[model samples]
Target: MRFVNDRDPLPLIEQLRRRYQDQRQIAYVERAGDAVVIDFTVHPAAATQGCGGANGTGCGCSGG
Candidate 1:
């Protein structure tokens, strides 16, 4: 996920950790003028479960 805002990213990261049960990690960050962009990557297993279509069964959308 990408967060575009002027505020610090720590709060956002904390919030995401709580939301995703600490399965999220910060991949990187970029600065765009006054806004900061935060990129995150969730654990593979968590991603698959969150997608709700494991093996392309439910939503017909593969998480792979």
Candidate 2:
């Protein structure tokens, strides 16, 4: 997933880390003017390890 934000996304990145643990990874793709771009990558093995939805985002899972 590509994230485009108006400002630095440090807090959001921290939250992603807490939510997904090592299951997901992120990297800075770009930082131009007011746009901050980040790539959120999810490992395939992260799918079957938790109680969240198919993408493991806890959107539709009762275990959240």
Candidate 3:
């Protein structure tokens, strides 16, 4: 599990998902002030523990 901070993570995440497909695991994103924080987990077992969808839905973990 690692955190990647970006002003906009959608484009990058989309590209990554397309390039890696199922090889990549869960991806969670949240708004942090003016920027978006993206958390990417490569471990398949961690997928179930991840929050949010590929479309960036169901993300209440940030308290936003």
Candidate 4:
């Protein structure tokens, strides 16, 4: 997906990287004036199940 913001989202992107680890990826697409464009993608195979089972909480606990 594409993310457009008035300011660079570098800090948010870093947070996402830490949260998703190798499960997701983010790229800087472009910069125009005060607008910043980013590309965020999730690897499909890594998203089949949640860390909290199928509940999608990603809490890294068993039993949803």
Candidate 5:
């Protein structure tokens, strides 16, 4: 598991869901009384966006 910020260079959860182009997982949380209900989606690819890493972020894809 990982945490991402709104400004992260990687991508938004929504974006990743789209780019994967395959079965993906999504985590979400909801409030129920005093407890939080965590939920997940088994598939997200069909709803994700095509980023291509696609924007050439200069992260050095070769694992620098």
Candidate 6:
């Protein structure tokens, strides 16, 4: 299946939702005061820290 690139938030969000569905557990959205939070509350140990993009092995974590 081919995924069409959506520049908008909803489609992008949904795409990510499906991608991590099995491995990551729950994914949801909520209001975090002034800003919106797209919570990717994942499996704690499974998630790794993002690479600084210098070493090139970015762990695909948030900071990356």
> Highest lDDT among the candidates is held by which one?
2
- 1-64: candidate 1 lDDT, tens digit per residue: 6767876677767766655554567755777667777787767876656543323344444543
Q: Rate the local accuracy (lDDT) of all candidates.
A: 0.62, 0.75, 0.59, 0.71, 0.42, 0.45
List model 5 lDDT by residue over 1-64, tens digit each. 4333334232565676555433446554544454444344434442343222423343343532
Model 4 residue 32 distance off true place after TM-score fit, in angstroms: 3.8
lDDT of 3 by residue, 1-64 (tens): 5655656666767787765455466455677766666666565643565644345553466532
Q: List pairs with backbone clashes in candidate 1.
A: none
Ranking by TM-score: 2, 4, 1, 3, 6, 5
Task: Quote model 2's TM-score.
Answer: 0.69
Give stretches of model 1 more than 4 Å off: 31-33, 51-64
Candidate 4 local Cα displacement, residue 55, angstroms:
17
For every candidate, C-alpha RMSD to the true structure in Å:
6.4, 4.6, 12.4, 5.0, 8.6, 10.4
**Considering lDDT, which of the candidate structures 2 and 6 is the better prediction for this target?**
2
In candidate 3, how many Å is residue 22 off? 1.5
Query: For candidate 4, what is the total of clashing residue pairs?
Result: 0
Error of 2 at 25 (Å): 0.8
Candidate 3: which pairs clash?
Answer: none
Per-residue accuracy of model 6 over 1-64 as CA lDDT, tens digit each: 1223223246666665555543344333444444444444456544453332323444466665
Best-performing candidate as measured by TM-score: 2
Judge candidate 5 against the unseen true structure and give its global Cα lDDT, from 0 to 1: 0.42
TM-score for candidate 4:
0.66
TM-score of each: 0.49, 0.69, 0.46, 0.66, 0.28, 0.32
Q: Which regions in candidate 5 have their CA more than 4 angstroms from the true location?
A: 2-11, 30-64
For lDDT, candidate 3 versus 4, the one ahead is 4
